[model samples]
Target: MTSSIPSAVTVPSNNVVPSTSTTTEPSTSAEPVAVAVEDSSNLDNDLLDILGIDPTTDKKYGKDLHKDLSVRLQHWTTVGLDKDLKKELKDRYLTPGNCKLIDPPILNAEMKAAISDINVKRDKAIEAKQKVLTSAIVCLGEAITLLLPSKDKDTNLIKLLMDAIRIICECQHSD
Candidate 1:
């Protein structure tokens, strides 16, 4: 997520003094301005940048940020945000009592729909598996009867045997 331009501040520098000086140099326009280099607090500044808030201009930005976060935490307590970092960021950028947080309705609805779809698919899979079990049992019974080498094969009883098989299969197939 690269930004078009980086966030940075152009801090005004003060004239620096030399360490070894027997005689103080007279204040003149000929001397070049010397600024002390200091490390910027990147994390704090970044959080402010993300929230579209500037900390330097506003005196109450830190306090406002804290208050806003506290109110948000009271309302939506399920984000599970990093405690220290969240507070730090909030303190840096949030305006006091700001109520601009986006609601999670969309996410919640999508999750519910996904759960419903999964349940429906699971039910269909179970039904299909039950059908396969019954089909296998019926096929096995038919194969065994057909392979029987008995000479006194009661052809008339075959009808009754088939009806019994059907009943057995129906019972086994019942979910």
Candidate 2:
């Protein structure tokens, strides 16, 4: 006589059963069977999902990802981020001592100050370059005017123009 056994054991949806089991019959032992546990690393998984980054293909963890995450943390409401998620982002992800993407890890108030400082410096640099270029163009225009065979071409002015042209040529070479 054959004792009939169920081919597949019906466990709860939360529980996982391994597919490599060779036994057709259920165990009669009093001890509990080992089951696969769900991955409880929700924070990492949530970050990956939100960033739309595939861990398998993308090995890069650079400033872009850090900046994106930082922006998300700051502007949580823009993405309709849940309160619990916001809490997790602030508490777990936005720590200064955490990921050092930017030197000293600019975040929150520091990030704001750093950005302002950068903008100010960038603007100043652009203004200074513009001034130099304007000066150079003006000098070139004056040199061209001196070259035009005009009646009032002073020897001193012609010498100055030659010097200006030499300086401009040097600047171009340096650049």
Give the runs in model 1 whose Cα sits over 4 Å from its true position. 1-115, 144-150, 154-164
lDDT of 1 by residue, 19-79 (tens): 1223455334543333233345545766757877556767743334477778887665567
**Which candidate wins on TM-score?**
2
Q: Which ten residues in a row have the lowest lDDT in candidate 1?
A: 98-107
Q: Which residue runs does candidate 2 get wrong by more than 4 Å? A: 1-131, 143-147
lDDT tens per residue, model 2, 9-98: 444333334532466555554433443343436557677678785567767564554777788766754666576753453444231233
Error in Å for residue 15 of model 1: 91
Candidate 1, 127: how far from true, in Å? 2.9
Model 2's lDDT to the true fold?
A: 0.50
